[model samples]
Target: MFMVGRESEAFKHCTPIPILGVACYAFGLHLLKTCGIMRSIARADLDFSYITSRLAVMSQPAEGLVESAYRNHAEDVRALLEGRHKGHYTVYNLSGRRSGALSLHSGDATHMSGGNVVDCPGWKSHRAPPLSALYTLCEVMYDFLEADPKNICIAQCMDGKASSATLVCAFLMFVNMFPRPEDAAQMFAVKRTPPGLQPSEM
Candidate 1:
């Protein structure tokens, strides 16, 4: 009677329970992948050490400060460029004005080399010079992407999270329409924050 009871119990437990368990496991994985919260957590985990090291370098500015800063933060910048992390970043002004001039010249030369110079449309549509500057910057980034989509990731750092969010959204939209979302995601970290929250809230 005990053996008979044990056999019945085993038969009852073996049928739908395993199937339901497998289904539940698959569903949980799907939720995790689709929700993206875990991905963000993983990214933050991977970036924390590098970010802290960078912050430390930023604190010190005595003797070879520029070189030391670059040595410390160069990998972070590269990761950003490679789209492994999300943030707008630039090199610390290493050679001062000379470096700035060189970068400006390089950007200008790249634009001119395209051979399709167009006159700047008047800024009468916008009142502020900063607005005009913003337009110009957008045009430059668009042109750069048009010329070599694979080589560049454009980001701006005004209003911190809002600017980053806008840029990321635009990039994702463009990537979805023209090229590929996975490719764009690989090239730029998408900003993630709950809606209606300011950067300070984070």
Candidate 2:
């Protein structure tokens, strides 16, 4: 629970803010800003489960559902639930060191775009990674979202910056139905200041 990019000074305005510099301080600030609790004695703890629950409460899907499936081989997954339209609990991991699953199901006919589902005819785009690669990732993402639309999807890389952001932005545009990659990027930037723009490797 490292507060990767929260500058300590950001919370200076909050009275009686913790000087301990713990990651939970950021969560407190967020809660204070959104929940409007001054003299904030009882701090709210936000772990993965808390976030997942909050999203469910707000009718928002969980994060990382899409990226998890994309990172693994599809056939390796063991779908906990299966439907003609989609499948769920798709667990897969090649190395056996760490295993993961997509918790949702979607109909087979639906194509994922921008963090949402769409039809083939409507899936139009000219971008890097090519359609084949994009479709494969979309299928994985769709499975997770379909299983539980309110589930959160998570992704990570060594740096936990651009690579993670790329996958997230991809899901935002492809499955979440975000209109533009730039829009997705801006959304991420709000949470964390992004590094300098770099040319796409592809």
- Global lDDT scores for all candidate models: 0.27, 0.32
In candidate 2, where is summed lDDT lowest over 10 consecutive residues? 51-60
- Residue 51 lDDT in model 1? 12
Candidate 2 deviant stretches above 4 angstroms: 1-131, 195-197
Q: Per-residue lDDT tens digits of candidate 1, residues 12-82?
A: 22221223244333221221122223233223322221111111001111234464432323343344333
Error of 2 at 107 (Å): 21
- Predicted structure 1, TM vs. truth: 0.31
TM-scores vs. true structure, each candidate: 0.31, 0.37
Cα deviation at 77, candidate 1, in Å, is: 2.5
Can you write out model 2's per-residue Cα lDDT over 87-195, one digit (the tens) per residue? Answer: 2222211111222233233323333322222112222112233446455654575455444533333332322344445545554445332345665555445444452
CA RMSD, predictions in order: 17.8, 14.8
Instruction: Report lDDT (Cα) of residue 170, candidate 1.
Output: 33
